[model samples]
Target chain A: MTCPEELDPVRLLTPRAREVLAAARVVLERDGWDTLTMRSLADELGIAAPSLYKHFASKDALRTQLIALALKEFGEGVRPVSGVAALVRAYRDVAAAHPQLYRLATSGSLDRDALPPGLEDWSGSPFLEATGDPHRAQALWAAAHGMVILELDGRFPTGSAPEATWDELVTHFG
Target chain B: MTCPEELDPVRLLTPRAREVLAAARVVLERDGWDTLTMRSLADELGIAAPSLYKHFASKDALRTQLIALALKEFGEGVRPVSGVAALVRAYRDVAAAHPQLYRLATSGSLDRDALPPGLEDWSGSPFLEATGDPHRAQALWAAAHGMVILELDGRFPTGSAPEATWDELVTHFG
Candidate 1:
């Protein structure tokens, strides 16, 4: 899928840096954010930790790149903006497909200063497009996020998806 | 406030164990769950880590106790259940009051088997009491959770509370 230029924060990275980031994503999926150390990432890439640091200064910088990637992919996965149900469905599908990325990008306070300017807003613009009102969009987005997160964490009681819960959310917003 | 018997998971713990859990809460708030260790709790209590282990076998068990306490307090905080607006208000207030504990309790997969039987359900029963339908209740709970978590993490654009978004959530459910 073609990512919008605004959403593609990694576009500024050199080809080798992009490769390091790709490896980082793999490591993040496997080891999670907490365990994704520079050494571990270097080990994954078969490079010395010092060499890896040349590509990305610290794990935090690497994490910022990953969050940008997550935003780009998640934004793409949920757009072009459509009806509330479709948006919610797309949101859940993208997050469910990339649960690790979803949690890493969203679970903590975002380093807005580090992230590319307007990239967060551009990615989240689809929510605005769907609802036409900021508050409603936020509510819808949060509801979808809550459902996706709870579902991913298996916080829901059943083994199966909570289809009815999702439907109720959509019905209210629709 | 009087806690319902089923909701009080810490009730069965020995006096000493309860004191250990109390110390853990202080440490958890001061340092997040990731930083909260047996050593830290023991340090807070002026004891050694071994003493902490005797009270709670591992950090995970201690975490379970914290989750139980969070759920009990959160349950009481949101009740006695009232209208959707009131419930949403109460929910946000309670979570905001204990952001650290709220994140610890709800962020990951719950160890239902390890928890006191029926405590989770009893704590969550307020949602059902408000909505009168399981799916709707789940949706509302998820929405409230989503809003609260995002707010706690300062995910919203403004530092001020997203009152409009929260009202939108309540409007739909109410």
Candidate 2:
């Protein structure tokens, strides 16, 4: 194992930081991002608002950290396969399972430049490799994203199975 | 022109209601959905909060009206032709023009059952007819939505053209 001093600072967060993050997730999942303010998070953790600042510089900082954690959890659940279909399935499952969090990660106001290391690259590169062409992977990812948005929005037509559409997308584009 | 009494009640809204809606759009576009509130809207209009209530029953009511207005405007912009490409282009243009409004119309807290007459049907039926199959249309719509979200969120990689990605989606799926 690497020496403790050599550990990445972010990876070396204090236990209180981890607790703050966990409480933030609960607030996010329960009330959505708009409601997950620093004060609310602190209230949920039974602590003073300023105490959260020690763990997170600001609410936006807390949000970035939460998204990174969510992405990490999502990455872990993704199947260990290079096929395009599996990747789409993994992405869809995560989005469907946590629709609000998915929106926060995908479309929230978090600054992309400030995302934790490996997160943006993870989102960008793997799909490029999966389809063996950047354009194809890009189109495929967009289509998959559209389906998830539709599903979450309840806009999918009655009796239309999204899975079949996913299969068709894979067959036609993958 | 139809008689004033023959028009739908919503269509028969007072000029002040229209003004309220216009101001609400400006607020929504400028400050985003989270910042829009009855008090803020009244402040924008230089009116009392109670007077604004004469036009809208609650915040959710105002949101529903805003979404309905957006959908109507979107419907008017759709090309006369029924091809999938025209439909997607129309949707994309509207989304790009007003990203926040599109998000509100597509995914906000407006109750589907409570949508103004013809709004839900308007969004649901046309795409189905364009693609010539419900399932295909559903998938295509999702892909288009995904592309729009990615574009709005700057998720596309540097040097990649979203329009080209859109063209690729239409060619493969249309």
Candidate 3:
């Protein structure tokens, strides 16, 4: 995932900090959010845990950066689709492509204060642009998110393809 | 919630184990699954952690019980609704009521091997009953789940009521 210069929030960080962010993403995708720790990330980076503190003050701080990366990548993936059905498909594909990052970015309380301004809105503009209504877009986005996350979590019945469900969701809004 | 005699899986447990299960529910809802430990359950029960193991062999074993309990309660809550709109509403209400348990039960790779046979099907029957098609029912369930989880996690924009989103989903499926 090439972070386009304009949309890249990590550019503000020092070059070494950016490397840490890259490594963190690898760790986050390889290991889940719960198991990813400063110690784990340090081991991933071939550095001591104390040195990680210099790059990222804490795990929470490091996580904030990782979320930004996920947002950017997810946003880029989902932004280009033209219609409701296509948008849902793109959303699901992007999420499926990076299930771990998708879960991390979507689940739990988001710390908006720590994120760069408009980054959230810009990341989400594709939904509004597709649906042409904020509420509808949000509903569609929520529905799409729900399908992807449930599929990722294995909540749907075992041995059943979720295509019909996905189609049902798209048929509803499309 | 009163678990119906036939529906209650916990009925298989000994009396003391039932008490421990009840206490475990309280701690799970209060502290969340990650923070929940055998030691914590023991403390909640006023017994030593080692003694708690007498009731359940491992945390995974205990969690399966908790999952059973969640399936029963969620099934009970959602089973009676007659239509897609009402089913979605009831699902959202029940999930909102027990946010922690909803997350615990719904997220992750389910251990079907551990859960009682037919418990999964019985719990999910409401969706099929309401929709009258397995695929459509699964689709509606996934859409509703998407809305509930996003709302629970504060994924929707701050201060948004999400009513329109809910209405949109129901309108699609209904």
Candidate 4:
């Protein structure tokens, strides 16, 4: 099987593929993972359903690509921050900025085994290094994931002290 | 609205209600909250779809009842234990025994705003009292909820060694 070199770091996508991805992100942000059907995406992009098939084989393929894009965006958002405290702050900032996308990324929307060919390896290194221990890294991921969910669900107190829980979480990491 | 008289607290349900709840739990366990249609639950119980409507007004009504059942079962599971350490142990035991049910309870499966008529006072009181401070109660709930999700997702360590992370959380309450 030939690896999709179109996804390589040095390779650039054609303009139409870029447009498809941009439209997919809008669908993801607006309707979330459950409603992001290929037909819906085609409708959003003002293109025929068959056109999406040219860019992505199926809904699962489209999801894999969307997840890859979300992870890359997440990495970019958090890259400048250093240390656990800063990392936690960065994570919270990124999550708050893209609440729906973050929820979709963490909500088991994409099957781990079906990740875009090389994308899993590319994504793991930064997260693995952040927590030092693999077990702690996984726990931290859950904690952060839960935090985003709680925030979105309005479980956090709404008042003057908006960032209190987030500040406490950062302190725990430190 | 007339309150249903309290039954045998130990049993927590009429025999028929228990049968309905049991079928509901099976559906929830096999399929997560999103797919728990009223028709599906009736089909699972070998009853007509309309019969489920006799028991539960809607899917939300069924979910609210299921959560109430889960909370009562959870309260009973942890009642025999005392203090923070024992409470933490009981938390893990209940989570392990009924992983899906536990998820349904802690995750926002039940609409907090539209909780069943008398359930507002019944939910989480036992666990909260075990923690004493209201602030710490919220944190303890978050930690326990986060821990159980991680455990159910197979992120927790496999051995029987007590989790230091959990111990630290309990320490905050003690």
Best prediction by TM-score: 1
Winner by lDDT: 1
How many clashing pairs per prediction, in order? Answer: 0, 1, 1, 0
B-chain TM-score for every candidate: 0.94, 0.83, 0.93, 0.73
Superposed on all Cα atoms, model 3 deviates from the true structure by an RMSD in Å of 2.3
lDDT of 1 at B111: 83
For candidate 2, write residues B35-120 as lDDT tens digits.
Answer: 88778888999988888888888888888888877766665566354788888888888787998888777773546565555555
By DockQ, the candidates rank as: 1, 3, 2, 4
Give the lowest summed-lDDT range of ten residues in model 2 chain B: B1-10
Q: Work out the TM-score per prediction.
A: 0.95, 0.86, 0.93, 0.75
Tens digit per residue, CA lDDT, model 1, B59-146 = 8888888998998888888888677888888888888788899999998877888777877887888899889999999999999988
lDDT of each: 0.85, 0.72, 0.82, 0.63
**Rank order (by lDDT, best first):** 1, 3, 2, 4
**For candidate 4, the TM-score of chain A alone relative to the native chain A:** 0.76
Q: Tell me the DockQ of each model, to 2 decimals.
A: 0.84, 0.56, 0.73, 0.25
Per-residue lDDT of model 4, residues B120-152, tens digit only: 344455556776744444545555666666566
Task: Judge candidate 4 at residue B130 and give its lDDT.
Answer: 75
Q: What DockQ would you assign to candidate 1?
A: 0.84
Off by over 4 Å in 4: A1-18, A48-51, A116-131, A156-162, B1-18, B34-37, B80-84, B117-122, B125-132, B154-174
Task: For candidate 1, write residues A1-174 as lDDT tens digits.
Answer: 457675588888999999999998998888777788888889998988999878787777877889989988898888885888888888988998888899989888678887878888878888998999999989988888888888777888884447898899999999
